[model samples]
Target: MSAPEPAKKPNAAPPVTRPVFLARATYRQRRMRDAAALLPILGALLFALPLLWLGQNGGEARTSHVMIYVFAVWAGLVMLSAVITRILGIGAAPQSASDDAGAADTRRG
Candidate 1:
């Protein structure tokens, strides 16, 4: 059994609240990985701007359809190579687990 108390302190400390959530640094790492994905898209946008400008006159090609088809295939191969390299991490993902670990150590250090 406990006795009831009726006492008041004139200067009581305020109640404290702590934040409820925390995040992993790997989240930032994943964000950087996603940003690496955006590079090819940036490159494509860069390539598109000049084509858009050139076609601003809305002129048709004088060559036969075969020429257009061949160029399309050539462009496809180049874009495919870019996509494959980007997907395989040739851009900015820094190539090695060793590098990732070294970065982590550097950040900590």
Candidate 2:
């Protein structure tokens, strides 16, 4: 007689995991928020870059050039923040007149 076959191993359950991809709108919103969160850090790093030039070329970097760079970065950051805010629907109008009325009533009460 042939040797008895080995007992079959039980199947293990697959590991739990999140979906490989998020919904399109959700993914866009998350990326936008991430960009907003990182903006300040980016701005900080950019602002600091001018300091590195202080020691270069015997410190001959012009003040006006640095000022222009700083202002340009500032303006760019502002524009980026505005675009992100608009996309995120921040500062949007109230959904309805009733919502505004309710808020006013609560404030008065």
Candidate 3:
């Protein structure tokens, strides 16, 4: 027969376990931050897309079309940034006077 397992002490606390998932708000904030981080890369790729068009049709891509595309991409990126910032509550909090004073003190030191 197999030996019996040792019993846990009666007074010992149960082992703590981490939560399986983040809270809804925390998960959303993290996702927003991730989107914010990826925004620049997405913009870079979008801007580079026009270059690919330049090589197509024997370099016949129209300058006006490219300009329009560039502007549209720029506007889209700005809007996306604004949305992410708003969702993440970036700069939403009012700055306290003490915070400014701390900065000033740091600069003087």
Best by lDDT: 3
Reference-based TM-score of each model: 0.29, 0.71, 0.70
Tens-digit lDDT track of model 3 for 1-109: 9999999799999889999999999999999999999999999999999887854568769898999999999999999999999988899867899999998999998
lDDT for each residue of candidate 2 in 19-78, tens digit (9 for 90 to 100): 999999999999999999999999999999988786456866789999999999999999
Answer with 1 or 2, whichever has the higher TM-score: 2
In candidate 2 the C-alpha lDDT for residue 82 amounts to 98
**lDDT values, one for every candidate:** 0.62, 0.91, 0.92
lDDT of 1: 0.62
Global fold similarity of model 3 (TM-score):
0.70
Steric clash pairs (candidate 3): none
